[model samples]
Target: MTRSPTQTGRRAFLAGGAALLATPALAQTTNYTTPFENSTVVERDPSEVVRRNISSFRSLDWRPYFSDTRNGAVLVDTTSRALHFWSGDQSVYKLYPTSVPLTEELTRLGRTEIVRKVVGPEWRPTPSMKERNPEWPDYVGPGPDNPLGTHALYLSWTYYRIHGTHDTRKIGRKSSNGCIGLYNEHIAELFGLTNVGTQVLLI
Candidate 1:
């Protein structure tokens, strides 16, 4: 099925990514105004930040990134702070703004696949996370305050996941510790689309 471009300037923005930022049509429609920067310091509270990252949200063909969309494919572009998904049959495609790792040291790249799916997922800070923030709670059950929001898709890599975040401001920013984060509604849609063994790649 052909996808309808309901939002004005979205087609142009997706077609060219950063290159289209200069166009007046897209500039007027887009809300990204923050300058992009690499920082070593973690954003403890992203909501307090006045500016957000100007992510290069773009649509991508899956062929170049994945050999095949076997059980479907998910590609997370750390530099662009965007995630791309394609169905196995090549009938569906989706692009979403994402929150990536805070720093280069925290980022992981390469191939991985979804091994599990969970609804109302619990949260546990990793050992390293705990070491860094000792005051953080050891565990958190699912709720509005939970870091991992409504749904989570577990990846083959340990302590890594493509999950939803309650914090909407984090999207389109370098706000995640390690995992790729999506808006709750977006993750809910993705959760229904993806299944176990769905191929994933982070770049």
Candidate 2:
């Protein structure tokens, strides 16, 4: 019987331990722009930021220890601010930079499954988020400035999402309020490939 990508990827994760791969420099370039491409609130170039941080972006083949039996899990590493998707093949995995909330709670760290996928997602700041920042809007319509970017992969666990960001500079950094953030373009591509019921492991 052929092993599923989930099975192989899970096995890798269990056996590989938590040692993450080194992020290599990215040589690719694109005409990237902030998610706020249409907004005039603040104009800034994102391609330049990407050029500066290019050295910190990377995607690696998931090691055997990072494998998943489901063959369709989205593995996230808070320490590295990186997310991986096992392509049902041990030799192939897609990687993207991400931002995870900075915390030290072991119980908060674990695996969950993707329960839904939202395109052009709206933003409703949580009570906790509002409390921390009183000026936060009650709701933000989907657009360039929306924190959820163009797509959001809603996790089974409440109050968390693998979504897009307006700030490209935050990628590969531990700078979220307890959610995973990806670049708008990156999340758009990821959303197309991901599906509901995909496993999400945050370690």
Candidate 3:
């Protein structure tokens, strides 16, 4: 199958990044910590920032949101940079730039229902990751301060995940330790709707 210029571009970028990751120079990985972690990634007045970030991604209200009627599924139109949630055959929610550049595969960011949802999650630091950041906390229960957030939809192939963040500002920007983060509020909603076996594609 023929790939588009955009696909080729993204692929080249990822390949280059992977090469960098494999480099002996960058092979020295470091444990990532946020202001939230020292403070447990939590603070007062989360709603104000959460509410604002929600609007920043797309100028629509997320609460009474709409999704598609497409088999309780999601179609992340990477080309359009939009995230469409379908309930059946109709859309109940459509969020845009609610998006980021897809770096891994499948040309997108968000996970599906199967691989996207987990409860009472643990933060098992990977061998490589731990080697880099020996200070990273061991696996802990799901909560506001937990690195996994209240709920997590782990990516199938690796330790990477599409999880929640206390740092709401990270949403529109491409800032993360390789995971895709949503505000705590949005993730809470996802927790209620998604399941453990949900499939998450990153094209």
Q: Rate the local accuracy (lDDT) of all candidates.
A: 0.76, 0.65, 0.47
What is the TM-score (0 to 1) of candidate 2? Answer: 0.67
What lDDT score goes with residue 66 in model 3? 26
lDDT of 2: 0.65
- Tens-place lDDT digits, model 2, residues 1-203: 99999999988875543223223222122321322332112113322222223433455444533455354667786766677776443333567777667455312468787899999898887787778667677888898778788899998888888998886555665456778888888788778767787777787
Question: How would you encode candidate 1's per-residue C-alpha lDDT over 120-176 as one tens digit per residue?
Answer: 998888999879877778888888878888999999999999998876666766787
Residue 4 of model 3: what lDDT?
100
Please give each candidate's TM-score.
0.76, 0.67, 0.51
Residue range 1-203, candidate 3, lDDT tens digits: 99999999999987876663333111111222322454222223323222223222332322243243233544443333334343343334434233233244323354444554566566676675557567776665666556656667665657666666555444444344455555566666655655555434443
Off by over 4 Å in 3: 1-71, 75-83, 96-113, 195-199
Off by over 4 Å in 1: 1-55
* Candidate 3 weakest lDDT stretch, 10 residues: 23-32
Worst 10 residues of 1 by lDDT: 23-32
Question: How many steric overlaps are in each model, in order?
Answer: 0, 23, 33
What C-alpha lDDT does candidate 1 achieve relative to the native structure? 0.76
